[model samples]
Target: MKIIISEIPKEGLDVKLKEKVESENISSTVIAQLRIEKLEIEVIVSGDLAAEVKLECSRCLKDFNSKLMIPVNVVYHPVEELKGEDNYEVRHEELDMDFYSGEELNLSNLLKEQLMLNMPMKPLCADLCKGICPVCGKDLNIDKCTCTITKTDPRFEGLKKLLK
Candidate 1:
């Protein structure tokens, strides 16, 4: 759905979208409920989105599926304002702002951007994941490995040799 800036009605536009995005890390249907309102040269988009994402657990290194619910609140400014400028420094209030080119705004692209931005840095399958074994290379969560685990401080090696 492409929304024209100049055609926005005074009562605002309510959009319900179910868009499929296929990318490197994500392949699922994004469901978003957005409200778009244009105020002079600025456009405000506020909504909530939900999607199912495939993620790799950082600790156990296993593939898992998780549901993500993200809240979107973005203010868009026309990119025409920065056409002749080489570089523009954003202020503190401009951190959450986005730029729109021309009169059309591709809603599918915006929903995809919101999905990527809300992904967790470290994904976990479970809260108590035991991870993998350091010695024999086995998943500790599946079964207990027979390898003996020990903790040795490298700095105490010389001190232990002097005592011996």
Candidate 2:
């Protein structure tokens, strides 16, 4: 979704929308809940986007469906005003009127940012996922494997002798 800065009035504007998902593009349907309130030429976007995506579990390496909720709140600044400032600082009160370049606002970048922030660092299907067996590379959650699970250290030979 693109919004032209010139279209928004000084009093600001509000937008509520829902985006549909295509099976070819994304695995799950996504809902984009947006509230765009304009302050002069700048626009303040505040909302939460929720979606369910199919992801592989990091530990078990199994496919799973996970829900994501991304909250967004950012100010758009005018391109001309944001140029050549060594230390650009905006006040808390000015958050509603952040500047951006050009009269058009690209919602793709903002959506991408929210998705990235909401992504899990380490995704797991379950807390106690048994994971896969190291030797035969078998998924332990499905069935038991005869692979011997051991921990050995080359520097521990002397320690082993002492214990024996």
Candidate 3:
């Protein structure tokens, strides 16, 4: 979804979209709403996006699907204005601001970015997942391994005698 700056009306534009995002981690159905406010010298894009994301459980390495909601709010300023401004350093308040060179704003890139941000750093299928057994490499969540495992390191064997 590309929008031309000149085509944006003075009252701003409200856009509703439901499209398939071609990504490995994101689902095909992506629902989003974009409120584009064309300011005097900048454009403000703010809305909400939601989708189902395919994720892998970090603990058990199992695949799972999770719902993700991402709030989109960003300001796009002209790149020319950024260059004309003093020493190139973004202030704390302008951290979310982005610079665009052309007259068209790419909505696909914005949706991709929001999806990326919504992904969990460490996805988990369950909070108390036992994970895989270290001894037999069996998945503990399915069945328990019969192996009696000792967690002590052999390198500390000499230290055990000292305690006696």
Q: Candidate 2's residue-wise lDDT over 48-159, tens digit each?
A: 7887877788878998999888777788767676679888777556343434677788765566556655668778999999899888898999986767324556588588
Candidate 3 residue-wise lDDT at 47: 89
Q: Cα deviation of 18 in candidate 2 (Å)?
A: 3.7
TM-score for candidate 3, please give it.
0.79
lDDT digits (tens) for residues 1-164 of candidate 3: 88898789999999998867767656646789989989887888888988877788887899987888888888888888876668766543643687777898888877887787678998889889888877788889999676633556766757875888
TM-score of each: 0.83, 0.73, 0.79
Give candidate 2's TM-score.
0.73
- Candidates' C-alpha lDDT: 0.85, 0.71, 0.80
Candidate 1 residue-wise lDDT, 1-164, digit = tens:
78988888988999998999877888978999999988788788988999999999998899999999989888888898778878875542733688899998888888889898988899999999988888888989999776732455668868977998
Residue 75 of model 2 has an lDDT of 80
Model 3 global lDDT (CA atoms, 0 to 1): 0.80
Clashing pairs in 3: none
Can you tell me which runs of candidate 2 are displaced by over 4 Å? 9-12, 20-28, 92-99, 148-164
Ranking by TM-score: 1, 3, 2
